[model samples]
Target: MPLYLTALATLLLTALSLGPSFAHVLEAPPRLIVWSPELWREATVFNGQFELFARIGGPLDVAAMLAAALLTYLLAGERPAVWFALAGTCLLVLGLGAWFTLVAPVNAVLDSWTPGPIPSDFASIRLQWETGHMVVAAAKFLAFASIGIAVLGPRLP
Candidate 1:
């Protein structure tokens, strides 16, 4: 019963965390093509507006990872299910790694900018940021699917 509850929590948290990442993925196409000034303005405005998301997403991301880990532990000795749980947890970790390595640096660069001149390498930065989010979104989607399999596979015929 406790294991079932934990698996449910893990699924919910993971799905919630995936929401922002998927939103970013959807935003990337329009974002990637805008003029430099427009991009800069959007980036700055978005940075200002993203605090709420950060506040909500940060904890959810951490909780999802923790919950997935716990689910993996609980499923130990359960064949196939345990493997899926482990894969899900690993994918979440890797998604976070991609964010820190790719997205966060770009964010730091954007955050450091003032209303003055945009950087010469703004395109490169934008591409990296968008690509990073896409990668994270893919990883998170897979993680959610894997965790779903972990929880439900055993019950299915």
Candidate 2:
């Protein structure tokens, strides 16, 4: 049961983290830029709307994941068992932390980059930021999938 709960947590978080894949991005010829400026605006607005939803409900989801970790500890065994549960929890935590710390802010900067920008370097920086966000997002997906698979496959002990 604990393992299932852990898997559920990972599954939910993964879906949340990666579920917005098509919101603001699309495939262009060679550069991965917004295919539709209108779509970019629409997607950003939609994201803002869902963010209100997250504000109302996101913490509860996080709390559930934390609770699942403790439940695994209590329902399972001692050190080694707890360790696996902890790792599963940590993968989500670490991935989210990476998203907020390392990726999302750069995304914000890129989104705010202007036509009358400071320098050509700003565009280059925006490109780098976009690339980094994609990499970090992919890493988040990997972490999420790993957690989900681990939880599905075995108990902590």
TM-score of each: 0.91, 0.54
Candidate 2 stretches greater than 4 Å from native: 1-6, 21-84, 107-119, 155-157
Colliding pairs, model 2: none
Of candidate 2, the 10-residue stretch with the lowest lDDT total is 21-30
RMSD in angstroms between candidate 1 and the native structure over all alpha carbons: 2.1
Whole-model lDDT values for every prediction: 0.87, 0.51
Cα lDDT tens digits for candidate 2, 44-94: 333464474347334643654565455456535644545555665565566
Clashing pairs in 1: none
